[model samples]
Target: MSAVRENNPVLTAIQAAHPVLADDLPPLQAVDVAELAAMDFKPRQPLLSPWLCSQDLAMVFAPRGVGKTHFGLAVAFAVATGGPFARWQAPAARKVLYLDGELPGAVIQQRLWMHCPDVDPAPGYLRIFTPDLVTEGRTLPDLSTYEGQAVIDAMIETDTALVVVDNLSAWARSGRENEAESWHPIADWLLSLRRRGIAVLLVHHAGKGGQQRGTSKREDLLDVVIGLSRPKDYDPQQGAVFVVEFSKARNLVGDQAESIELELVVADDRATWRCRTVEASTFERVVDLANEGLRPNDIALELDINKSSVSRHLNKARANGLIKADKAARS
Candidate 1:
């Protein structure tokens, strides 16, 4: 009985600490101490560290069609399955569990397969859960219930390294994007997963105005905040591109001034993403054209910029909504 109870640490601790058990149970003994003096708890270097030395709770937000989901899927695949993400080099192989509230399983599968052609989903590795868990009535479900707890238990049981939740709005009980207080419970709940040395990334949408919905609460609790914007110069029909930027990082250097332009392409059922360089001057001009709702040619002449440059900027901006087109009826 003692051996059995010792194997289940959480329950054993609970039972041992209960007042009822205090009188009858054997007094707790301090276990032999190892070399605690050598343990290191310092904040880890972000770019070079694996496992983050601690779990990283990051909120990634972008407007709809900004490829937030696509970008998240790619990152999740890279981390869970192992690879080089935008800047972080690949770590030792680990499991990844993706929980998506908005995307269907098929769509998630498509994105994963596109980005990671070699990855597979079985009992433990690279699992995708699409709004399947019933977490209602609880701010965050206690995984104590088979469904709720099963995910975390599986994560621990399989030693999962990353868990990705796609889009914050999907599970928010309040459903009010502007209400920061309402998100506190959910954000804190997700952050708790970090205690176990697993990284948790939440996919969320920003307001049309470039601020994340529930930004105050979510941002305050997270260790990192990544924002993806559509390049003001990208075109929708040609392909999708995003301006990937880091809005916040507590444990690592925040990449406020650093930005990457990424383009997506799919062929032979595989998706490839490549990073490109953009001239700051030209990119800003494109943003100007987008904000003003100028046609490509008009923007070109207005800024005395090349038409091709205007087109590129316009496409990126439209995809990211650095500028929005007025509805035909409104126009």
Candidate 2:
């Protein structure tokens, strides 16, 4: 039998009968079963099992510096090597393919060695995408240049069961994420990969309005939508906690409950992340004050950062504080 016949009997049979139905044959280019599938697979359940037990196409959306990369790396290492995730019970370990679109290869290596020494990150198992750029600096493919199909092909070749895309914001072409058509290609590509049973975890930034980034289509394309937020039920310093909630899950059990807390810790030059519950209460208070009487630009000036940074941080801080905010005051 031919290779196609040996691999896919259905395709082989269809092709074999093609000559008989030549008169009724449709243009191959016009035939789009995949596109039809993509349109219909809006609410998919590709990822439902906890941890490594099942393949999951999930996303984590949060503001910057909220530890999405660190959190993802920890989870990927645990899944790759099979151990507890930051001390939580984890599923069986397997090889993980991490596509670091934002961080450099050297930075990624340093992070893994410093934070996850237990993980035996061999070249075969833990892969990195560090194509050379310029003599002055090296850079990975940005969102506009990144092709999900290419990454998928690499994953299949490497037998990677788990894949992580750090910061979807960086991987996607620059534009208004609210535009549906702009994200269609990336969404469709991700869907095609998810159908092949690879667990893909992507990190993205939550929007200014405390919403997930990208159009509603992005959420529809994902099997699991997980949100990271600080607990607004009380003052963060009263042990104000960070939380992980299953914003959407096809197979997971339980109410959208708090899955984990952001452990607050300081790191030195080693890129080490340590967590111990700290008082976000003060931060929350600052945000509440800002929302009530302080302008965002003023707050940013006080914090010595950009207005956009202040806006993002304030959204999260107010969220943690559960502060009812007025648009007029912030304006």
Question: Highest TM-score, which number?
Answer: 1
lDDT of 1 by residue, 1-331 (tens): 8887678655554453233546777898754447555555544323214324347877788888878887777776665555665555556456777777766557766776788736543446677666544357633423223233333444344366677777666645453556765565465456556656667777888885797875476677777777887655466875677777767766555343366777778889888777655455467666765566666666676666688876676566657766655321111
The best candidate in terms of lDDT = 1
User: What's the true lDDT of residue 80 in model 2?
Assistant: 63
Compute each candidate's TM-score over C-alphas: 0.64, 0.59
Instruction: Give the Å shift of residue 183 in candidate 1.
Output: 2.6
Report how far residue 46 has shifted in candidate 1, in Å.
6.1
The models' CA-based lDDT, in order, is 0.62, 0.59
Prediction 2 global C-alpha lDDT? 0.59
Residue 276 in model 1: lDDT: 51
After superposing candidate 1, which stretches have Cα over 4 Å from the reference?
1-53, 118-123, 132-158, 175-177, 251-257, 280-331
